[model samples]
Target: MNSKKILGSILLSLAACIWGGMFVVVKIIVEEIHPIQLVFLRYLVAIVFLILFSIIKKEKWHWNTKDFRLIVWIGIIGNAVSIVAQETGTWLSSAQTGSVITSATPTFMVIFAWLILKEKLTRVKIISVVMATIGVMMIVGIHLTGKHVLEGVLSLVGAAFTWALMSVLVKKVKTYSSLQITIMSTCVAIICLLPFSLNNTTALLKINFFEPKIIFCLLYLGAISTALAFVMWNQGLTMVEASSSGLFFLLQPVIGTLLGWLLLNEDISIGFILGTLLILGSVWVSVKFAD
Candidate 1:
């Protein structure tokens, strides 16, 4: 209710909106660029921004051995693997399908937290898992009537599982500022993309860097979505409970679904709305009693 919490909430909401909007952006960008290149560029721009901020803020550059290990693991899983999975998944599935399946991340996170971090799973968590599963099924089952739907469904499930792993990994690392973490993770992603980036030299060279859409995506992804949003998220979590933070994440699918419909002319079926409600209920129950 205070200004800090209010600002955090707004920033978190904005982050969710950006994430939601990203699927549509990816769909558009892939028309002109390979997914790996696009994902690489997204992080490249973001890494530059984070580096600039670290310099401006005089954040310490020195990192301990333990911190280095944590960043390396986080970078590999969270940045490299998660992006690849999500991009590949979206390519295999519709944005709506990908978004809906992604809503199950909290469910995966709960299980991971319990096993890895010794967090107790209460009755609330159990109910949440069920609701979230049903919601996911409603969306996937309704939309997945095509022959290739199984492939899409598998891709989405893979993406969800990878992202869930990243979320748990984030909670485990205690060292490094969020900015440092972002920078390190992005650098790792850039390294991971080197082979693909090198192979696509002709295409990369032909790309008009000044293109309006590319510029827009770069700015939004780097400054607004990646750097500032990440900082705001870490700050918000400091002021709020973990369960409350997880609740806000439920906004991702809702905002993404609506934004895709409006901006990209992506279809929104009855099942999409119903599925969103189911996921929302799951998130609510998870957050309410996971304390």
Candidate 2:
């Protein structure tokens, strides 16, 4: 494999790991703050860091009007819509259901990449996606019983589909630098989210921003998870096939499961071990055999 592809794989994997770790932090903070409020604050801080990073790197922000539409699609589908659907689905359904449903993202990504980008789906890629998906189902488990089963299932499925679409769309953006793409899409997402957040103004004001834990969580989510991770992911997407890069997302659940075991003292079952091994093997095979 070329160095760029290798680097892209590493960066994407690291981003996945960072995001997985954020789940633990998010679980803690969401207990005290509303998810919408947290999302608003998290992206607000993230955009600031992103802007500063762009300034430091001196990355050009210029883009044509046509590119603006691409950014808008990415912002809406990947950030605003996907997040809202995922959060709403998790609220209506169980986390296990949400995780299991969203784990279908790689499968969706492969299909979208094949259909939209005309990317070839080789046998190795297909096998890896299947193995990793089964691993994710094993790790996260699944239970669909709920009052809002249809709504939750549809929302979660939409989230996964839109997210996969966004990953594929990122490949079509050739005019903007990865950093520029991240910033524009993020700015657009924040704009899209603002109207929904306005009603929560009073609750937003009441948040204890001065609390050390809250401050830490905000910075971690904003800088490390959102800003840095998205940049890495976008850059990695540029360097590799979207379908191949999608396989790396499986690392998120593996890392999340391990973090749960270490931090929350969650019990690891035999299924967890088997799932982890399958996921790791899938990633290895996908990266090694990627065309």
Candidate 3:
């Protein structure tokens, strides 16, 4: 059990760190390709690599009817719906607002795990989530006032809720391997986003894929962020209780802020350090002390 938790926590933290730095990659190239189009393309690249990976590992691509639907549920809500909603929310509101609000995703995950999976809401879990969330708020600097705050906030909350629900659902599906679930759901996401990506076909042609930088960024998104990270996250979910799984997500802002400071020359204020400590401390407390 201890070994399992250690391995799961490592995988989960790695996923968070990859995603945390993903913003830097997206920031560099999102202007050339639209968000929906970029999402489609990244997953397209991801699916190919994932398929190759499955083949290499000899991962069985089989699922029963009921489990298939649940896998599809994960893909639609998690990858397709939640991502589009988050894109819309970020568009309609400030990035700062999106960061602050979407950080609530883990909190919602805690709630959903309790409601859907009947996982215990222990005092340690509650306290960890509270401390981590406050750390996020501090790092993001909660400024919710904006032109489309109401609509944006709603979309963001929906994204968080669905994502949380999807995380729990991953644990619910018992038969599929993490690789199997990731591959199947990614296929679903591609189908859902296909029409939207089609609309951006003209824009897609404008991109110079030959440019080393563009190629690198797209590959990073596809291979590192989507393929590797999703597999890690889903596999981690299978090992840990759903309630504890979300605590690892709190590592994102810490990693993101550190990267910003290191790569982007962004200033790290005193609050950033304190918040990082709190968030990291909470994750440690949860992993080390949880029964």
| lDDT tens per residue, model 2, 1-291 | 889998998998998888677656665677677766677778899999999999999885664888789889999999788867766665666544556677788999999999999999799989999999989877867667879888988988998889899999999998998889889888988998898788778888888899999999999988999899999999999988899888887787777666766775644445887888898899888888876
| Per-candidate TM-score against the hidden true structure | 0.84, 0.92, 0.91
The TM-score that candidate 3 achieves is: 0.91
Model 1 lDDT, full chain set = 0.68
Error of 2 at 118 (Å): 0.7
lDDT of 1 by residue, 1-117 (tens): 566656655665566667777777776666677777777887878877888889999998676787678667767776777777776667666677767777666677677767776
The number of the candidate with the highest lDDT is: 2
Return the lDDT, model 2, position 8.
94
What residue pairs are clashing in model 2?
Answer: none
Error of 3 at 141 (Å): 1.4
- Score each candidate by Cα lDDT: 0.68, 0.83, 0.81
lDDT tens digits by residue: candidate 3, 1-291: 499998999999999788777655665566677778888888999999999999999976664999999989999999888876765665565444555566787899889898988888899988888988888867767556768778878987887788788999999888889999999999999999999899867898998999998899889989998999999999998887788788787777776666666775655556887887788888887877778
Stronger candidate by TM-score (1 vs 3): 3
Runs of candidate 1 exceeding 4 Å displacement:
1-13, 132-142, 145-151, 233-247, 271-284
